[model samples]
Target: MQDTIRRNGSWLRAAGIVVAAVAVSAGTTLPAAADTDSWSYLTKMQAHEMWKIADGSGVTVAVIDSGVKDGSGWKIDSVLPGVSYIEPPFERPDYVYPPHDDFVGHGTTMTAAIVGDGSSGGPKGLAPGAKVLPIRTSVGTPMAFAVASEAAKGIRYAADNGAKIINLSLGWTPDWPMDKVKPAVEYAQSKGLLIFAAMGNEGEGKNWTNAIAGLPGVIGVGAVDPTGKAMPFSSHGPDTDLTSVGSKVEIRCAENKGWCTGNGGTSFATSLASASAALVWSAHPDWTANQVARVLIQTAGAPTDGSKRSDWVGYGVARPRKVLLDHEGDPGAPDVDPLAAPAAPKTPAPGTDPTAAAAAPRAEAADAESGLSWQWPALGAVAAVGLGLAATVIVKRRRS
Candidate 1:
């Protein structure tokens, strides 16, 4: 049935869906303390930096996953009415039929990672002041053709509805191609939307090229551990644009179950990266998407390749504070893309094969200064303060 649905014209060209299915014989359990510890570190650093930038305050992030649970300790003051794209055979009339009803906690977890305020000692988000627009798709099911169609619809809806950042934590392997998904992504980008996506968690498996992550304009984020090392399970390659703390991040687990302890993957990492962009965007309202992106790439932590970049870490871990504090950084020419080097080739259009195009040889590994790395130290020290005193300490540190 799903294959038949994909045969449709125009829609058949969408990106492939790369879903990672971990064994779930055991029921989902609450995350352990170690997970909470990691989340505290990431969010605490975000707060201490005081990155209330112009990139994301008035911005709206459309979270496309399972539905979000409203009272999950996040400061989500407004949510545009959302719709459910999960094709239904089993129906519940009591449930408002569409938005904010999360049977599976994935979407809610992503939301908290982006805009949560740490009201109940849970994880604090990078962009606490931004708004969220929830769009529910699927949970525990394969990436059905109908679901992909619905996701495209959701992306279009988000763009039409005025969302500035679209965060997609979902992926599938046997799915649509770029031709189908490109229109939707282009539409959103045309509206000045910043699309952020997970690089997939199949690092332990084939570790195939992630679809959305590989898309030309989209920003792909990878996960890093508390110690600043890439997680063994984190997907790698030049496709990754930035890194964020993802290992052992804690979030609301399930109904009445309190918070879970093991929230690790590119799924959560992408959300944090989006929130980081939001903080910078919120602070600099005048900057365009390209300008904002350029700031991030330019100010990111040095890569492993020294002078150049590693295919695994790209420009390296994202550091929003570097952009926030650097009064002299150039946002770059408004028309140029930040990801592309001055001489990098333009992306090929639909029906044009990219592999056939001649490209520059990879540059020699460059040497970079290995001074005190900022992201890890900031995260480690903040987590040490514990969540109970996070707000007070964060405020005091920012002032000082």
Candidate 2:
């Protein structure tokens, strides 16, 4: 059950994220353009080196964002049939045209970061050989609750469809009812889906913990700039799990017309992290989700040891290169949750009702660029028979 998403193909969050849209009537890549020069983040992350051994061939990353359409030139494959949660009134007007005319090109961008082949003159993805399972969910502006519910459902759809790594460049405000997303998160984890989410670009704001990022099994990610320093906009809290290079990142729009430069946020970092996981998992097919997760963390470039973690960068930056190159790290237990202890499902807090909360902007954050953590919720009523989505991720996040 979801509301009709606005078909203008736009998700403009007041959280300060500039949703750059570049319309290309002919190309197949995606949305958005940048005013800055191009960046080569994958090279900086040393993805090419890892590709020598692992190209994430067997892994499938489920991108839960606007929608995905592999543009004309890029060599993207195995985008399994996807379903959209945006109801009719707001569905893309050109639905019959192609499957991935993503409104904001957000999902498409994330997908490319995970699996785009460089052949199309677009930016190359981290795990170019991995498959993508695109699941469309509403994101940005006026509808926090609806976005949460829709995203929850999308997560389940991805996991059920055989996605090994689930990437969510989306997140909810701190006070939004955790209940809305908790169940779906749990369900996905139970099925062995490794969840990756943006930590929200709210670190300089109230610096609160993101509801989805803070969940037990979810790997909350932060951003690092070209200099490999923490980005000021990335969300921060004890709950943050890891950091990745989110700044100066390049991603071609869905239509493959133009690209965004210097894009920085947990959203980009989340996809990279997910792509990195795909590399590790693909290289070690026998490893369980938990084992893959543990190896990634173990090989992460941490400045400190396990006893202390940075408040801003969490377990330090994601360096799948270290894991891939060394080929040695204790995966620990095959059936264990690495992020947090198990907890019972939480009910909505009294006086903190999801609807009553003001669309009053709460330190909103989405993409990099000085975004806040949460936009105030828009008032609208929508529903679905069962949010198999929300329950799916919460199951994974809460798994012990």
Off by over 4 Å in 2: 1-40, 76-78, 90-99, 119-121, 141-145, 252-257, 304-307, 341-400
Task: Please give, for residues 1-400, the per-residue lDDT of candidate 1 as tens digits.
Answer: 3433343221212111111112132234344443345455554355655653333578788987767877776755745567677664333323332678664456777787777776664566677778889988753233333445666778888899878789877654443334545678778888888888776554534454356666666777766665556654455555677766665666544331345656346777778778877877788777888787777766766555474444445566677766675553578787666665532433546776433312312221112111001111111112110001011110100000
* Model 2 score (lDDT): 0.60
Model 1: how far residue 25 lies from native, Å:
10
- For model 2, what is the alpha-carbon lDDT of residue 227? 53
In model 1, the runs with Cα more than 4 Å from the true position are 1-36, 43-46, 51-55, 76-78, 90-96, 142-145, 177-179, 254-256, 342-400
RMSD of every candidate to native, in Å, equals: 12.5, 8.7
